[model samples]
Target: MNKDIRNLSDRIEAVFPKMVQLRREFHQAPELSFHEEKTPARVAEILQALGLKVRTKVGGRGVVAVLEGGKPGRTVALRADMDALPIQDEKVCDYRSKVPGVMHACGHDGHTAALLGVAEILAGMREDIAGRFVLLFQHAEELVPGGAQEMIADNALDGVDAIYGVHLWTPFPYGVVGLRAGTLMAAADSFRIEVIGKGGHGGLPHKTTDAIVIASHLIVNLQSIISRQVDPLQSGVISVGHINGGQAFNVIAERCTIEGTVRSFDQEVRQFIKQQMERVIEQTCQMYGAQFELKYGWGYPPVVNDSSETTRMAAMARRIVGDDNVWEIPPLMTGEDFSYYLQKVPGCFAMVGAGNEEKGFIYPHHHPHFDFDERVMKTAAELLIRSGLGYLSADSPEVTVGNLYR
Candidate 1:
């Protein structure tokens, strides 16, 4: 680490207590997606205290704070998701969520607190830095289609040069930061299959075509798309999360509905999976003498990192966290709404390790017992601050918008 970054790291360590307090306060009163009314107000107050120009309701409870530096240069963005999931809290901590059926199971509270901490640190060093820093507290990350697209619609990234986002992942060990040059996260799409067949007495199997049997066959065949169709090197997942059919066991159901999600890193593979899925459902239902309807709802796109931006940010992260703490992990099959922002601007979304076995904070995200190690909050904050500063100081390059849909 260089002298400048070492000093910033020390400053971040000094603010550890404040970061913990902020995260605890947010954890106690969690809010759901697109309904973060009080969350934006609280985050705005913190940014206001740091003397940054704040804009609220950019995209329905999203807050953007622009902090101008002492010198003139390009603008950079640092983003943190502000919404929590609708999961019941099971942790037995004093700071456990007070809101029922809503909790920060995905560590969004820690993300918000880390960004606020970065805002505070950057505000103090404004005189020594160049260009502007935009701190984005986004809402509705867990919601399909994401709040990031809404923020772009509101022109949040209009003048931004580069953007950076981070997620606190439990899969990585504590004190380590993970990054990848491309395809950091997968695209998520949902599908529903409805099988229609004749209904009759359960005892008379020959009298009616069993929709339940047809649905079962379709579900099993759907798994072959990943193993047999897609290349082994390409990552894809087809998971049937829910199934609904007849209520009574004695009666043959007229219709059976199956719902699941499809995930993939490559766009071509994602498209191929969807196409093969339709074929599988149609052929399987026909074989069972049943009619089928397939509905595929588009979700977030794959998060592809810009090579130059990711490489530069990784170097800065190594400087802040040291070489031993920096890691280049393989891309995850998980999906992110931040992919929307990367589509509009050249950016990178990396992961910060928040798991610590000693503190019993090793649960995966979205789990009821999931909790983040508050000590890692400062690390995330410093990484955001340093990355923003570095990007702003670096040369401003032009970004080309290719055929994103292809």
Candidate 2:
């Protein structure tokens, strides 16, 4: 490693303990989407302590901190989500969530801590920083019409040349950093359907319009939209995860509700599936003489990485983790609100491996038992700072757009 890089590595190691403590504090007091009252305040206080100009409650309980470097150049934004899931923490650990039915099962705690660590590192080297750094601690990433949209509405991307985000992913083994040039994650959309019918005795099926039966048919036909309606070359998913209906075994259900998620990488395919699903529900209900209501909510879009930005970020990753540990993998089915940031400006969202089966950190995100190796937070922080600095120090426009690195 270069002498400067080695020195930065040492600095990051020295702050690793602080990062762990921050992550633990967040884990113990996990907050849910849009209801993150305390999380944003805590983030604002920390950023203020770093001597950065902080903006509180920019958009839906988010905090934005701006650090102006000594030199003049473009502006780069680094983001971290600070909300938790509704799942109750099942792991018996010291830092487990104290709030019932709420936990940071998605590793947002680690992401927040890592971004704080990056802030510490970059703030210390303000003289060497050529451009300004914008630190965004976002909220409600797990919910639809994500916090990113609100933040952008409040001018979060104004005057920003580029943006970046990181996720502590458990699917990959520890020490691996995943990156890709094109779409890295799928678009997530959800749907809810209500089949309404007349109730009657279960024994006399001919006298009643069975809502449960209609819902069952609708569920099965929804899958056909993905497999039969969509082109085979394209990928799509229509999964019905929830079903609620009848109260008694001898009574026919008057209404049944079904809820599920839709995921796709292509916009055309995503729209096609939505239309097909509505068609199936309408036609199926008509066939059974039942009334139906359907609601489709569009969530996060697919996170598409700019080729130039991804290539430059990958080069920085190789420098930190060696060539073998850096991977350009295929797109995943998971959705992220970071796609919103990418929609406005060029950015790359990298997945940092935090999974370690030996240490019981193998569970997937949103799982009650999900946990991650804290050491990866150091790698995450270092990578963010390295990418930010690399983009700033280079003088050429191509370098800023992610062609050549300093």
Candidate 3:
């Protein structure tokens, strides 16, 4: 690493304790998706303490802090989500979530803490920095119709030239950075199928059209839509995560509900899956002599990173954490609303490895036991702040917002 960056990395290390303390505090009292109250307030307070202009209740519970540097240049944005999942915290630790039935199982706490660390550190060195920095503490990333839409609608990225975000992933081992050029994450869509049929006594011979039976058939048929219809080379998933109906074992169910999610990288394949699902539901209901109601909700688009940005970010990552630590990986089936921001500006969403089996933080995201090495927050901060500087440097070719300081 160069002298400047090595100094910056040391500065991030200096704030590592604050990042850990703040992360623990956030984890101890997490707020759920779309219902955040204290998290945003706390974030705004911290940013305000840094003497930066902070905007709160942004798009309802989202907070944005703008840091204008002492020098003149373009604008860059960094984002971190502030919402937690609905799962109960089952981990036995001092930082275990105090919010009953709500926890930060997805490493969002770490993301927020890392960004806040960056903001505090950068705020101290504003003169050396050329461009303004917009730190977005987004809400409700765990739920659809995510906060990214609301923030962007509220002009969060009004004068932003580029944006970047990170996720502290446990799947990758510690010190590893996962970066991909295109389709870093999939586009996720959810579907709900409701089957309506006749109710009758179980002892009666063929007296009722069983909705549960119809739902079962529909689930099986939905599998074929992706398995048999989609090309072998293409990737897609259609799993029925939930099913409900039938109160009694002897009585036939009059209605049944099935809910599942679809994930795909290709838009054509995404549309094709939806179409095939509709066809399968219609035909399956007809075959079972039942009626059906289907609800398919489109979710965030796939996270497609700009090739140039990914390359540039990768080069910076190598300098920060050596060549062996930087890695180019395949696309994941998971989804992120960071895709929303990427849609507005050329950005890259990279993952900082937090998994450490020796540390017993090996659980995957969204799991009740999910946790990570908090030290990874330092890596996250170094990458986010340095990458932003690299992009906003006066000599950089991609001088996106040099004139738009507002």
Q: What would the TM-scores of all predictions be?
A: 0.92, 0.96, 0.96
Best by lDDT: 3
lDDT of 1 by residue, 1-406 (tens): 2455558867888787888898999998999998898989999998998889999999777999999989888899999998999899999989999999999999999999888888888887888777888889999999886799999899889799889989998878778889988889989999999999988899997999899999999889999999999999877999999999987889999899999999988789989999999899989988888998888998999899998778776776776678777788888878899998898889888898989998888899999999877877877887787677768766423212221110
Worst 10 residues of 1 by lDDT: 397-406
Least well predicted 10-residue stretch by lDDT in candidate 3? 397-406
> In model 2, which regions exceed 4 Å deviation?
1-4, 395-406
TM-score, structure 2 vs. true: 0.96
Model 3 C-alpha lDDT per residue in residues 294-370, reported as the tens digit of each score: 99999989999977677667766777778888888889999899999999999889999999999999999999999
Evaluate residue 143 in candidate 3 and report its C-alpha lDDT on the 0 to 100 scale.
Answer: 95
C-alpha lDDT of residue 204 in model 2 = 95
Which scores greater on TM-score, model 1 or model 3? Answer: 3
